[model samples]
Target: MQPFPSQPLDHDSLHEECGVFGVIGVPEAANFVALGLHALQHRGQEAGGIVAYDPERGFNGAHRFGYVRDNFTKASLMETLPGALAIGHVRYSTAGSKAPVIRDVQPFFGELAMGGCAIAHNGNITNAAALRRELIERGSIFASGSDTECIIHLMARSIQTSIPERMKDALRRVEGAFSVIAMTRTKLIGVRDPLGVRPLVLGTLHDGAHVLASETCALDIIGAEFLREIEPGEMVVISGGEVASVRPFAPAQSRFCIFEHVYFSRPDSIIGGRSVYETRRQIGVELAREAPVEADMVCPVPDSGTPAAIGYSQESGIPYAMGIIRNQYMGRTFIEPTEQIRDMGVRLKLNVNRALVKGKRVVLVDDSVVRGTTSRKIKDMIIAAGAAEVHFRIASPPTAWPCFYGVDTPHRDKLLAAQMSPEEMRDWIGVDSLSFISLDGLYRAVGEAQGRDGACPQYCDACFSGDYPIPPSDQIANGGFDPEGPTTLSDHTAP
Candidate 1:
């Protein structure tokens, strides 16, 4: 077995997966959709796609494996694309499937008895193996090894009377987090999984056009006024320029992943009607009220850690400084193709501002630390940069178990905090002091849990407290990444 933390977190407290944008309005819809997708490019830079529907041409899927700007141009889109309704997807593969290779591009296209179904998915499903087996047994063929493919197959096999009915029924059978945008011959539809583990928002343009996206930022770029989010466990169908919902698949509940506000969604966006930036600021205020620390300067780890650090500094009456500088051009360290490159990625990814950190007792505010390896290296770098003493504060709780839904976290041993005591973890990370935000305090930081109903609450705290909102596969099996298989162009090395 590989050495790994039993569980890891999926949300980094910054940068979310791909965004989906669709327009069901006018003839220029394809062009407007492309422009909206450009706004969502940050969610996934590795790939971009837009599938436009034309009655004369059926459904056309255009994909490129690169940044949106580089892959598409107004001229190319104008020349090759034409339609009144189009759906687009940007991608960040949680699995190693994501790559610069053209074959790895998304808006996965497939033709079924029900007509053309182009699916763009965000988040992972834990029960995918079981569902895949069920489909394979029923004689459905699959093209890719992605969990997203499982959904296409399921939708094809459902005995529902209509395509939309079959799609919703297919979703009912799958378990885990998912928010998907599916484009059909004459419709653009959005579906969020039962728990609403992922987010999907709806909007409309001035010309009576309906738009759907993962975040409001995408809508903003395309000038679509915000509508409402596709309700959790609900399906919104847009056909013939009309929008309506399928029955709520699961009981309406707010199991929205809390991590989104802390790290994933951009601060400028509003999630579930609340400002993420303001939420993070409130978190900082709460963290200060609950766990105050004295230090010469409060410095965040950079990017995700910045806003919270500002809040902490402001509430604690300490000065806030930009103690760390990120190498903005550094590609994903996890995506580095070689170990040597991965090591260099860490060094080049973040550089401490010696002038800000040196000779000062610094308070380090980081979103969360995964396997202790990265934090240890970060600590060494800061010390080398000449900080007098470094104290670490995790804005979230420790991750002790792997997440089965969407996050690639597998196994428990890789987590530094799994079996070790706080002091042991602190020593392991080589920090002067360490403390994670308390679990209760963490919920209070979000402040949306207004009730405690039977069983569970509105949020998913499984990764932190070992209480899964849903059950994992109980089959007695032990296997993972087939190391002998032909390697694809990806980065699936140690996390």
Candidate 2:
């Protein structure tokens, strides 16, 4: 089996599958869902959809191929989805075709034996291809090519009397990471995979409405009080402003994705009760301690790299400077579909501060480097702006393996770290020096005092360590991937 086709262009950064938001027992719940989706727009920007249920209107939904603010915020659209219970999804295609299809936009609804239910998911289903083949052989007619639709079809086949029960039966057969938010006429349900590989949080509104979202940032958008994260393998069914919890899977240790703290999550959000921003800064602290370099200034790649740069500067006793500035108004997808424009990609989004970086030995701190194309471009920009030397300090471990748990990573061959040594990468990118935080150092940053527990890792560092918590079943069956043969990150990779 070959690697998945590369994205349309080099989007240097990785993307999580989507973001989900659901609310029950709130007036104009669709409006609240829209607000939550707006806050979660960072997680996904390809498309958005909302499903709402009202006593008089039954179930109504609007799926559009664009941002939530561009689609779901319209008064006409929000009015059509009038209800006290609603669920929404902002999407970036990981399972289906990369091209945006309205049919593939989620908050997917299915009319079951008992009632109708809508589901929005934020993780990849590793065994989806196998599940789809089986379901097709068994006479299941599918609408969208999305792996998420497999869950719906599976639910349709379950011989259960209740929607929640059917969902449980269906999820029991699902493999890979999934944090699901589903809504029925009166009940809203949330569930996380056995490993908790993705995040799902529970919150409560002032009016006692219950909310389930992919991140705490979404909860904050609606002024909801953070309650707690839904436990791995746990399911919560909310109806009449009350939540009922259930554990349908066998007990297992939590292995939430470590990369959430690195790049996927918003800095202001919280994960495992730890502040994400603080953790990222601590990652920078660790990087400074582990890969110290004598430099005149510590400059962040901007936005994602800000906290880490601050930590590095503080630790190394170097002055912090905004050597590079990002265009907040420029969207990541601003490039035209032309080679000339693609060559000018990073320039459109970022620029070096000529005066600040001129004649300075700059240390560039960034979250992670995927293809290395952007890193090379940034380094050239710095040098052309008159920087004497440019060193790179990455906040996370090398992303050598492609993530199968929701994140849209490039194929292994496309990953710079996967194809070359750190020294080789340093030369290839034309940087003075390059270093990535060790896996253990990253664990320490996230509050693991002694570093990653190899015997039973507290977090899923599959992309960095290649130790996948859940086997990528479909890829394995198709041939090429080997879970047991992961390339271990050695301390030497950091020079």
For all candidates in order, the CA lDDT equals: 0.72, 0.88
Please name the candidate that would achieve the greatest TM-score relative to the true structure: 2
| Residue-pair clashes, model 1 | 15
Provide the RMSD of all predictions against the true structure, rounded to 1 decimal.
Answer: 6.4, 4.0
Q: Which candidate leads in lDDT?
A: 2
Worst 10 residues of 1 by lDDT: 486-495
1-495 per-residue lDDT for model 1 (tens digits): 223422212222223557777888678577887787788776776678888878887777788776777666758655576778778888766543434455445677777776888788877766788888888988988777677888888877777766678788777787778889888777788998877878899998765678888888888887788989888778898876688887647475557777777776778788878888877876776677777777899988877788788888889998999888887866442355665664453566788888778888888888777676667767888899888888887787787756655554535655666768889888877899988877766676677454223255557665676555654542212343222322111121100
Q: Indicate the residue-level lDDT of 279 in model 1.
A: 77
- Candidate 2: tens digits of C-alpha lDDT, residues 447-482: 999999988788888788887777778998987576
TM-scores, in order shown?
0.87, 0.95
* Clash pairs, model 2 backbone: none
Off by over 4 Å in 2: 1-10, 95-98, 335-339, 487-495
TM-score of candidate 2 relative to the true fold? 0.95
**Clashes in predicted model 2:** 0
